[model samples]
Target: MFFSAESGQINHANGTQYFRGLEVKEFSEETATGMMDSLLYAPCDYVITQSYTCMSREEAKKAIKRTRRLLMSADDDAVSQRLDLDVALDLLTSGKIAYGKHHFSIMVYSPSLESLVADTNEISNALNNIGITPVPAEISLSAAYMAQLPGNYNLRPRKGELSSQNFVELAALHNFYPGKRDKAPGGCDGFTAHPVRRWLLYQPA
Candidate 1:
């Protein structure tokens, strides 16, 4: 079962639907486990879970700025660029934005969707200022759909795992496990990282 964003209708499919501009990749159980492990092991910056609500442009911009600063301060340039901070900023400022009650999460490290009905000119201008190509609604919708896949996991490292300070200071931090450690059957230590520190874990009723 899948959905067709182009037609704006849910469609049933025996196989995975390959929509253009959407990233849909099949992974084996081993691969899926690895993906989840990588995310689970990484450090995190911030974990925010909030009720569904609309934010004023000012509030949104402030949030965006904070996220941008955090990303930039990180050691990984890819992390700073991959989240598309500019697009999120534009969406927040687009006005009248609302997320549904069932799922309106804004995982900082995950890919998200902006309203298709937002003003293209405004979004384009915002992207242009950041030197990012404007992504069309179709692509954005497809990306959002991909994120909903059960096999797909968007993970970020927990705070204190990766220091935003200078390289020297970051290296000086202790290498102790951030969470409780469990002993595996083979006498190996197992660590469980909490990426969703404050987020709700939604499940079907």
Candidate 2:
């Protein structure tokens, strides 16, 4: 839930040595809706979504809509700092993509991805839509989510080495691969600057 360097000023608090972003005091549709509204005015430089599971298209649509509302109205400071990002990959509503709820996960800086998938033509028409790109959940999930998991657990040589296999498989469920130490061009295994650049671009001016 927290990325130190990626979190900017929020990584450390004046009063506390460590700070986690956004403690949820409440959870509900109204709260979610309210949060979504806030993010639009305070859009992130980049909004990344990582999933260890697949989301229905309908769910993806709903997620994109929520993201759009947030990115569009996010405040300049928050946007500049890339705050208030909705990063969970879970499907918000129920049902199937074709007949039920719409669900989408994205790594972008868009007001919404629904248009990209449902209304590509309209997306082309909109100005300043760079943040609106809709990549498959797998790409971002592989790159962002899996790559960010803390591998820094307490190590015990006598207890045997920590297995990255579980981590790798879990990430793969959502189409992600474990961040590999080896550097390969366009490799999905490790954290890279590409995601950061995406975030910075949408950062408020």
Candidate 3:
């Protein structure tokens, strides 16, 4: 994919385009509820893409082995390594955490190129305030955009390992503020659009 000066967007040979993509690299050590904090008031159009794939039992074993090997190679702190292993063990045994891999990217779109930049900065700042780190997709912009497509996990955009519990926490699944419908009685048109978000899980291929 390449940036088009004329269109002010990343352009594919086939004509798909996007203004910009920011990836969720790491979250702050401390996070609060509502991952999409200020997004509700976004003045420009945007998308929050999230894909999650549940790991098979064999995949979990391999992941644990790979993590242990990495820790050994890096000579990480013993306590840190133990903590990692403990979480893995807890996933395998206690089953409190559902093992999975996920991809989370936010794409902002606007007719004005300058607006795209400003909106991106605003979104990033808002998320940073809530302890989320979103960085430019850079070379992975194409892959990230594609990964957001429904049933497009087969392309295998880069993902980070996480547990269901952790995903729910990062996703702020507990954030629920119901609003009145647009045409409800008594002038209760508080929300413009209220969408029901559902988590679509895919069994590992």
lDDT of 1 at 105: 17
- lDDT per residue for candidate 1 within 1-205, as digits (tens), equals 3334531223346422223221112112111112222222233221122122234456556666776887778855766353656655555456524222111111222111233223233333433443334333253443354444554333211111111111222123233343322443443233333454333222212
Who is ahead in lDDT, 1 or 2?
A: 1
Alpha carbon lDDT at 123, candidate 2: 23
User: Residue 198 error for model 2, in Å?
Assistant: 13
lDDT of 3: 0.67
lDDT of candidate 2 over 1-205, digit per residue (tens) = 2333312112234331211111111112111112222223322333322223344555555655565566668743445322322322222333311212112222232223342233323322221232223223321233343333355122101111111222232123231233444454544433343322222112111
How much lDDT does each candidate structure score?
A: 0.33, 0.29, 0.67
How high a TM-score does candidate 2 get? 0.18
Better of 1 and 3 by lDDT: 3
1 or 3, greater by TM-score: 3
Q: What is the lDDT of residue 98 in candidate 1?
A: 25
RMSD of each: 20.0, 19.6, 8.7
Ranking by lDDT: 3, 1, 2
The clash numbers for all candidates, in the given order, read: 6, 32, 0
Kindly report which residue stretches of model 3 are placed more than 4 angstroms away from their true locations once superposed.
1-18, 30-33, 78-84, 172-178, 181-205
